[model samples]
Structures are given as structure tokens and as C-alpha cells.
Target: MMLTCIAVDDEPLALRLIANFIEQTPFLQLVGSYSSAAAALRGLQQQTTAVDVLFLDIQMPDLNGLELARVLDKGPGTDKPRVVFTTAFNQYALEGYKVDALDYLLKPFDYAEFRRVADKALAYANATRPTAAEPALLPQEDYLYLKVEYQLVRVDFRDILYIEGLKDYVKVYRQSEARPLLSLSSLKSLEERLPARQFMRIHRSFIIALNQVKSVSRSTVQIGSATIPVSDRHREAFDQFLSRWK
Candidate 1:
């Protein structure tokens, strides 16, 4: 099922960008576009159809996105549309999540980031609604849910470079990200969930993505300049795999 959405931004360029993004996505349908929060509120009140998501800009002349979100929260029933806050300021991110926003997009974001948030909104929308006899929209299987602090963060499998075990926790290193994601999860538990063909546990504390391995030696493997040790227990298996790979 297509998820209905609306964009509200005082800036014409930003509003147009979000609208275009919504139109380009197969699962998202742009139902409304408003220049201000007050106008968006009025439009939403008049609409007979339910909006599944809102791409809202936090700063505006009056009735800012956060205020509008509060108003919607107290409006009527619990079927309120999920919010995804968009703003240039990073300060509002904590506030946005406190209001239970589905996602947050910073200004100057590309279509790829927008699409990621859209997918999250779609998954949330479908999960909350009643199941229909018709087959539901199939969610993409290329992602993994990692519990980061109090929230479950969706991380794409392709983005993962390696995972390092730290006692009861694991640090997930990604391709482009400078800092790894720290989760209260064991390496053994995550190893079970990872695709065996794509991932390999080369040491007691480390699991590396096979395809991300840039180079290998008798005792170590390199991924994007990060050298990870291959323990004696796993060296034979790694050598066997390398022989087959060669």
C-alpha cells in the first residue's frame, strides 16, 4: 500500500525538493504541500484521507513544526501521522526524537537520505495499520536492526565494514561513518544473524565482512586501512577460504 505524505516548509526550494522526492518514491504519495504550519494544519483538517507521514521543517514564521506536532498529538485520536523533522540546525534532533519523530533529515540532504527516511515511514505506517487481505508492501531485506542505546536503529548490511566485540557490547563499523555504532549486543549473537557468505568471524572479538576485506596476511586482514587480527583458532578456516578465493 502506498503511504500518503505531506511536506510543510516555508522555503519554496526545500518544499519543492521534498515534494519531488515523495513523487519519485514508488511507495510514497504526496497528498499536500503547505508553506506554513498553520496552513498545513488547516489543510490536514479539511482532508478526508489520512496522511501517513509528514516531512516537516522545524523553523517557520508561526506555529513551527514542533508546535504543530504537539497540536496534532493532542488533536483527537491516536492515529496521528508520524513526523520526520527537517532542519539545518542539529540542535533540534534531540527534541525531534523526544516528540517520537520517525526520522530527522538535515538540510542539504540528498535524495538517498530522503528515501531512507521514507522507507522507515512506510515500514512504520504498515506496521501500525490493520492487516489487509491484499499482500502488504514487502520491506527491503538489506537492512539490520541494531539496538543503539534505547532505540533500535536500522543499519543497511551493505554499509557495514566490520564488527568488534567489547565484552557484552559490539561496535559496528560502517563504510563512510567515522564512528562505529555501539550496541549492547554480543558478537556471537550478531554473527548468527549475519549472512555467512558475506561475513566471517576471524577472531574472538571481531567479525569482518568478506567482501570488504582489502588485503590479508598470515595473522591479519585489512579493511579500508583498518588492520584486524585473525586469531589462531580461525586462521586455518581463513586460509582455506583464501585458497578457494584465489
Candidate 2:
């Protein structure tokens, strides 16, 4: 598979060198090359598909490479571009891994070194890339993939307690877990994708599995230790659903 990529560096020469290297690589495709992080970000925002990899320079004006990496890491999509930091300094190497960068290329490096890391990134991209067929959402399907921290995590539908919306993100509460799975997706998007017969949105910000509901009060639904509010807008529908249980 051809891995689409972009390069960002403050140095014009560095950008040109990386672009040239990418062009020569058979499996790599150079989508864009920018002199600054902001320009690269703007260009990425305009693209319909996420670039497969990014060759980033850590020390850039306005917005440094590290900050740019963090922003792209939390991008609003399942396919987050893998980052390969290109810097002259060795100090930021540790910081690069913190953001889960695929590889690092120290400056003054040659085409051989670039090719080595490029090959590694390509392998990773191919391994993690989802299959062409979308996951079936059948009634018997017990699990689904949720994009969390640049990785797609498989979550069993039965393990889910409820989902809480937090602006552009969602906190997926599941059984036997203290912390929720935070994902870069809207609750509405997840609500629409979930099996409607098994799950219901009881509030604008909440969606609960029908089986997980323990009890229903005047305006709240109980599930284990959590008490999720049933908003007026959703109350009538929820009442209709609860009627079937009786």
C-alpha cells in the first residue's frame, strides 16, 4: 500500500530534502511539504483523508514540532497520521515517544537513514490499517472499534455501561473499569453507529445500553453506581421503551 506523507520544517532546504527522499521512495507518496507547522496543519485540515505519515521538525517558529505533534495526535478521526520527528537535537527524542511517534530522524542524516525509518513506518501503517470491508453491525456482533489516542481499540458492546459526551470527545464507561475510554469522536456519531435496538440515547449527552439499565426514576436511569439523567426531550421515548419491559 502507498503511504501518503507530508513534511514540515522551518528550513527550506530540509523540507526540500525530505520531499525529494519521499518522491524517490516507491511506497511513499509526498502529499505536501511546508516550511512551518501552521501551514502544514492548515493544509492537513483541508484534506479529506488523513496523511499516512508526517516527517516533522521539532524546532519551528510560531508553533514548534512537539506542539504540532500533540495537536495532530488528537485529530478528530480514526486514522491518525503516524509522526516521524526530524530534529538536529537529541534532547527531544524522549518527548517524541510520549506522543507515540513512529520513529525519529536526526538531522544531518542521509538518504539511507531516512529510507530505514520510512520502511519501518510503512510496515506499521500496513499492519494497523483497517480492512476494506467495514465491520458488520449485526445483532450478534459483540464488539466495535473505537479510535482512542491514535489507536483503534476494540470495545465489547456488552461491557459498555453508558457513554458521556464531552464536546468533540466521548467518555465510554464500561464495566469492571475505573476510568472511561476517552475517544476523539462525538457522542452523536457513536449513537448513530450503535445498534438502536440494544442502545438508547436517554439524554443529549448520554447513551445507555438497554440491558444495562437497572431501574428508572422520575427523571433518571440507574445503571450500577451511576445515575444518568433522562432529559425531558427523551423522556417520552424512554417511557415507551420502559413500557415494553413491564
Which one is best on TM-score? 2
Question: How do all models score by TM-score?
Answer: 0.56, 0.64
lDDT per residue for candidate 2 within 1-246, as digits (tens), equals 899999999898988999999999999999889999999999999888779999999999899999999998777776778898999998986677667777789889999999999888765665456546633444456777776654557789889999999987799999968899998778998987788888999899999999999998879999989999999999998999878878
Off by over 4 Å in 2: 12-27, 36-50, 58-142
Candidate 1 structure quality by residue, lDDT tens digits, 1-246:
799899999999999999999999999998999999999999999889888899999999979999999889768875688888989998986566546677789999999999888877776655445575533222434666775643567777789999999986899999878999998778997887787877899999999998898888889999997999999999888998789767
Q: lDDT per prediction?
A: 0.85, 0.86
lDDT top scorer: 2
On a 0 to 1 TM-score scale, where does candidate 1 land against the true structure?
Answer: 0.56
Residue-level error in angstroms, candidate 1, position 182: 16
Clashing pairs in 2: none
Candidate 1 yields a Cα-based lDDT of 0.85
